[model samples]
Target: MTTNPYDDIAEWYDDRVRSAWGHPGDESDLLAMLTGLTGDVDGLDICDLGCGQGIVSRRFARMGARVVGVDISSRLLAIAAREESANPLGVEYVNDDAQSLSRLSGGSFDGVVCTWSMADIEDLDSCYRSVERILRPGGWFVFLITHPCFQGPGSRWVGAERVVVDYFAEGFWRSENPDGVRGKVGAHHRTLSTYLNGLVEAGLSLERLVEPCGIAPINASLPDTSKVPVFLAVRSRKT
Candidate 1:
């Protein structure tokens, strides 16, 4: 059976997302970098691709950007929508696949932000293509993903050293979430080259790349994670 990570663990995911004092608006550094690349967000339309529970979506709206959140999981979207109802942030939540983005208008978005969800997606090429189609010319597509070279389910800690066995293989494996509530969740793994080449094929020009030191909540617990790049953030512009 195919695995659904956030379906049942939506509550857990929501709590963790809210409690993450470390990551304000996913990551302060990421927001700064995205803004630097895309310019001011005020009065701009943005898509939160693969947005789970609309955590970052609301943040962007608070920053004066019109935010539209798209995700495949009904459970996650429900949570996001519920929160939107309570806060009236004007953030719209759509139940849609990131790989297609058919429901979103083409060339309508000023920027796309996919935070910590790139590895969670399987068909990244299609997602990039759809994002490119939805973005206006010169619009930026910014993403944060677990470093394909350093982080994965197969990682092992041997005396302070985090070692990974296979760097070339791309596949899905059960998630190792600390709460253990989402054991059936699968994390899709891909190489750095695959993502880079896929963006190039999608006709997006690579503008900025960031490897934040264990800044995200998921990697903050790992020993010495902050010392090395555990999460990689990339910004590409549609030409």
Candidate 2:
């Protein structure tokens, strides 16, 4: 049977994942970066690719953009739907695979936003291709993912030094943290080259790459601003 990490914590994933950082739109860094690349978001048709629970979608919708949120997790979609109903911001939530966002019309979206989901994708090439197909020329695709260098489930803390196994390796990975609640259920690890090459192969041009650090909620409590680079934010455009 295929494992679903979100399913295990479906009931609490929202609070845990959402609160893992401070505030709801802590992911606004990606949005800010994207808007910096494209400028102005009003009336834009935005697709929240792999949008879990519609947090980012809600933010975009509030900005007067037409937001369509797509994800594979039914549980997460349920949460997203609830938010949409309450907010009535015209955000549409669809249960769909990231690699094939066929349910959405082609060349329709002005921007595609994804958060913390790229590493979990098994077929990234297909995902990028689908993004290219769905976005109009010059449309932007922004994404946040785990930093391939320092973060993952296989990381071990031996004394004060941390050890990472297969940090450079790519392909499916499965590792369980001691807490069990946090785990790498299954994922594809790729280098910067892989993602850049995939974008080029999909006829997209890389515009910006960000390695965000010390942005987590816990970081605010820490005196020192060093643990790891926990996130990678990327912006690409269909050409």
Candidate 3:
């Protein structure tokens, strides 16, 4: 797949990823964090960047926020639309690259969220800047992504240390699926510092950082899963 498989994988995308994320402990941790982060969304204006299949997007709408979900893939947007209609949580959908949240009105949102999508973006600086532009001063920008400190392209999951090969830099990562070869998946990698600096450059202040050990059955056996963080959730405020 040269291009993003989201367009073609829309049908089965939800099932596959959902199964992986829906692990009992995984879901609980995410839900608990989200519930705590967003206690009462009675009238907040929220935007979900790269809101795949409207998972978190719809959830926010259900919390009584006026939600807008944006994505680059039409296929994912289609599925998100279907989900919006079926659930009818009043979530609005937009098809656009997350790097350009400027398409929306300035200072239009109280909270902006990006989940599991930052890794796929080529320009983290632009994306953070755009998010800052769309959010009101003091508004929150919550981002969830794969932990870059441990996971990177071609980094084998061999028990503990995710031995990364020649990918010690912060940029694009390429991996081969057929084997542990490089340059196959066109994977990208960025150091955690790059992301933090990007947010600071965008005029956002870091509030909290969380590395969630997903609530999957395998978590019980994998020592690395508990010792090392797998996913990161960053909370920031547009200042």
Candidate 4:
């Protein structure tokens, strides 16, 4: 079996996500934006694509959605399963690749959400296709990703502003900053057009898009990001 890149850092990543819950910024903003775009998911069958440790999955379950959390990392899924066993929210965690959720039945989901995990997926096109396949007609697909234009490789904060060294360099790349998440797991960078085009090609219709602004705990070396939009959230429907 191929080694999952997130397996080794599962604990570290879980801790980071847990810590973010206490901070009233990026994490909170992300969840708010997600739920807002999804509207009410009561009794809806929802899939949490690339669900790391049941963070968003639990939230969906709490909101009355039957949730399935899928990811490639067994270590992360273990933690998520452990949490489910402990709390028993009826969330099912599946160890599977986001690009090809072979175990999930087609047209089985009323909604699908991918949060902060799109960059981790290697093939955006395949992932979007999988999402469209799993979603029932008129089902919604919502996602949050670091702004492709401002958060790609070689981009960083200079004083109060963000600097992008290159926007057209699209591919897999690792951040030089050892302390950041990208430096550890790396990320596949895609242009905004590539992302939108992939969704359109997958038979998904764009509905709403938002560039959200929030303050999150950052490395001391970085400046305030509240004034700048760091993440982009999109809501689409399967046509």
| Strongest candidate by TM-score | 4
Winner on lDDT (3 vs 4): 4
- Give lDDT tens digits, candidate 3, residues 135-181: 98889998877778777756666666666665567677665544321
Residue 133 in model 4: shift from native, Å? 0.6
Candidate 2 local lDDT, 116-180, one digit each (tens): 78887789999999999999999998887766665554765555455677666877766566433
> Which digits, one per residue and each the tens of the lDDT, describe model 1 over residues 1-239?
12256787888877777766334345555555545555678898999988898877887898899999998878888889898888898999888888888899999999999887787778888889999999999888988776788766566556668788777778876546565422446678788899899999999999888776655445556677766677678889999
- Please report, in order, the local distance difference test score of every candidate based on alpha carbons: 0.79, 0.75, 0.75, 0.87
Better of 1 and 2 by lDDT: 1
RMSD of each: 3.0, 3.1, 3.7, 2.4
Predicted model with the maximum lDDT? 4
Per-candidate TM equals: 0.88, 0.85, 0.85, 0.94
Q: List the residue pairs that clash in candidate 1.
A: none
Candidate 1, which ten residues in sequence have the lowest lDDT sum?
A: 175-184
Clashes of each: 0, 0, 5, 0
Point out where model 2 deviates above 4 Å. Answer: 1-5, 22-39, 157-162, 178-184, 218-227
- Candidate 3, residue 201: Cα displacement in angstroms equals 0.7
